[model samples]
Target: MPEHIDKLSISVVVPVYNGGKTIGRAIEHLLRQSLPPAEIIVVDDGSTDQTANILRSFGSRITALSKANGGPASARNEGVRVANGSLIAFTDSDCFPEEDWLKELVKGFHSLEIGGVGGTVRAASGGLIGEYVDLHGWMNPQCARDGSVLYLVTANACFRSDLLFQVNLFDERFRKAGGEDTELSVRLRSFGYEFVFVESAIVRHLHRRTIRDYLKNIANHGEGQFILETLWPQQRWKANRRKEIVRSAAGLGTMLRFYRSYRRQYDRKRAFVFSLLDHCQYMARIWGYLRGKRELSSSSLRNPLTRDPSAVVYPNENLGSSSVLVPKV
Candidate 1:
């Protein structure tokens, strides 16, 4: 073993499905990090695409695990079980990390109590997706204090491995590929753990490639919130209400501000309208979450776990499959 083996630094966990087109590049980026991880594990969630073959090509450079079709949450749990590092870093297969990502992440753990840290995110392409991402440039060093942040993004986040085990990984019940990260983040905050924002560590997240794709992603966010609330009932009513209200208002304000600036820069009024429409889509989804919560609370018998009036049927088959394409980070 190398000298660093004694320290057993950070372990990076990447849960992949049909990511053949981008997974290799993601892994290559990690391997080149300034502070390379002690361990790198990729969990294949029953990928029917070239992902499985590409993983095998990596040889012993990365520990690859496979299982029947389970959601990313379950796949991540598997990676956590075999990781040897004290800290765990997570990034999606579609995102590319800056060369200093691992170094910046480790630097944030100056104190034992610092359980989590997140970095900045930018778009990979210069299209509509990139425009939307740029609109949120406040996420850059301009906004982050490098000390602490209200929220941390999973796409470029690192966590204390020990703390992760204590939280029991992400909720597998979040069958859809969304909001599981936020659900985990809010829970960690409730438990008194602090997350820092490492402004210098940047990730190029390849979000929705086109405008239509962006709207669809927003719609999924709605469904995810619904499922998350159903699983954690107490959290649904408490501080969650206040958080949602704040996020909603902030989102609307940000969209309007971005639209006016973008329209002036480019002569396209349509772009401004589309941006407004995206914000409206988000509001619609938040409404869906509210409705789903109300229905769940009013009709206890509707829960599939309960044998009562509604008698909801539980789908035995694993909800996540290789056919489903998750968002590009």
Candidate 2:
């Protein structure tokens, strides 16, 4: 670790909703980090299960806040508002970071210009969907040709606190989990900030177990992409309907190739099923994109570009009726 790392206070912020099944384990892993954070903040996005009770059981080990059912982006923004550290690290409630996760993430901030650092996410358990997710690298960070990260998944990422505030935390318009992180990264990059990928910093993720859950996640991703295109019209790729149809038709051949590839590892029946699921994933994304377009067109939401990042006010800043529990010393 660099000398400056000692000077930088680290805070880990986890945003969760209906995470009663996994939040306890996630908190335990965070508390056991090799490089302990200055504070661990968990924002409960109006979970209707035992999540609140589980968070309470932690007592003073963590700072817990409860708010209405805002999406993950809103919950994260709330966490950021109350975070006291100079560095903010975000991991989902379903993720369990390795003992040295925090230590490795901070190591990437070797330069001042590096805005944020992110690590890899591996499946915590083995399941058919988990294997498919790992094989496809769905949760991995996207990087540029030069090796710099284009976007860091919030699942295992750390950012300079000030930089997050400068970009106005996260756009609340992104009422879902998928695109907000990418949008924030895009805005940061617009200001000439670079992100680094730290391969050694790893987190174990509890992937969606069922195909329905997996496809829903993929659909959310499609909607998120639509939101991105809306915010930056210039970045939007030209949608050629005829070309898309041709591509979809060609995708069947690609699926066959995947079937052949998977047969090396699995039985013939399982390989065929996985290949079909891969094609279904593509269709789900398309359905989500169209749904997003319709929703955006029908809603009265303002153009995100019209908001000034520096002047934006997040909902959590006021606290209002939300319950806040300060960490016990």
Candidate 3:
């Protein structure tokens, strides 16, 4: 620990599933951070590809763990199991970060009230779909005053290890990357945890390029919103009963404004086209939300203990001895 800086040991946890193409790059970036982690832990969620092989080659440089096929939430929980650091920094396998990323993250801990810190998750260059995502600021970690955030995105966020334990980790029920972080954030907010946004601790996120993938992401976000709404009703953020006509009209107005401001980035023609596409995607998201609502209702009826009155499972019932530590060096 330096005299001027507080001693905050950070462990970087990256949960990867079939990210063989990008995991290597993510790890390489972590290794180069100015404020490197005490250990870089990569939790492989039963990837059937060369992801496991790629992790194996890293050897002692990182602690690689493999678990049965679970979503990003469960994999991240496993990473916390073996983490031996005061702070737990999380990022996705597809992110390539700037060198000072961790250094900037650590500065947030100067205030003891700060529970977590988030960096901007910028979109990497892709095709039209990616441009739409970036334009919309989808999945990007947002700006916040030092201590005035609900929670930060897990893709480029760091939390106090004790705070995570107090919250009992993420809900394993989320079988995708979608709603788990938001759910966790809701809990942290209720507990009065202060989340900060570090503009400099940035990572470039790889957005989906293909239309199919982009649409799938939009739908997943909708589904996750449904699950989150049900799980944390106290948040009291209700969905609009009206979707198509009202939302599309509002979207059109927003697009027109967006185009005028960002014409250099996306011309009028392209902006108009993307806005229509965005509306269609939003419509598709409504469908997904409805399906999720139906599924959640049925699941709740079958397992009465599935949901708490507060929505999330507090004290994490599944914090059993089942989690394994696969420190494959």
Per-candidate TM equals 0.75, 0.88, 0.82
Q: Candidates 2 and 3: which is better by lDDT?
A: 2
- Give per-residue CA lDDT, model 3, range 140-166, as digits (tens): 555456536765788898987766766
- Candidate 3 weakest lDDT stretch, 10 residues: 320-329
Q: After best superposition, candidate 2 residue 179: deviation in angstroms?
A: 0.9
Which structure is stronger by TM-score: 1 or 3?
3
C-alpha lDDT of residue 156 in model 2: 94
| Candidate 1 weakest lDDT stretch, 10 residues | 320-329
List the candidate 3 regions with Cα displacement exceeding 4 Å.
1-5, 142-147, 239-246, 249-265, 297-329
Instruction: List model 2 lDDT by residue over 47-166, tens digit each.
Output: 999999999999999999999987999999999999988789999999999999999998988866687999988999987777777776667788778777889999999988877766
- Candidate 2: segments with Cα more than 4 A from true spot: 1-3, 238-246, 249-254, 264-266, 298-329
TM-score of 1: 0.75
Runs in model 1 deviating more than 4 A are 1-8, 137-148, 231-277, 283-329
Instruction: Please report the candidate that would top TM-score against the real structure.
Output: 2
> lDDT (0-100) at residue 121 of candidate 2?
89
TM-score of 2: 0.88
Cα miss at 193, model 3 (Å)?
1.0
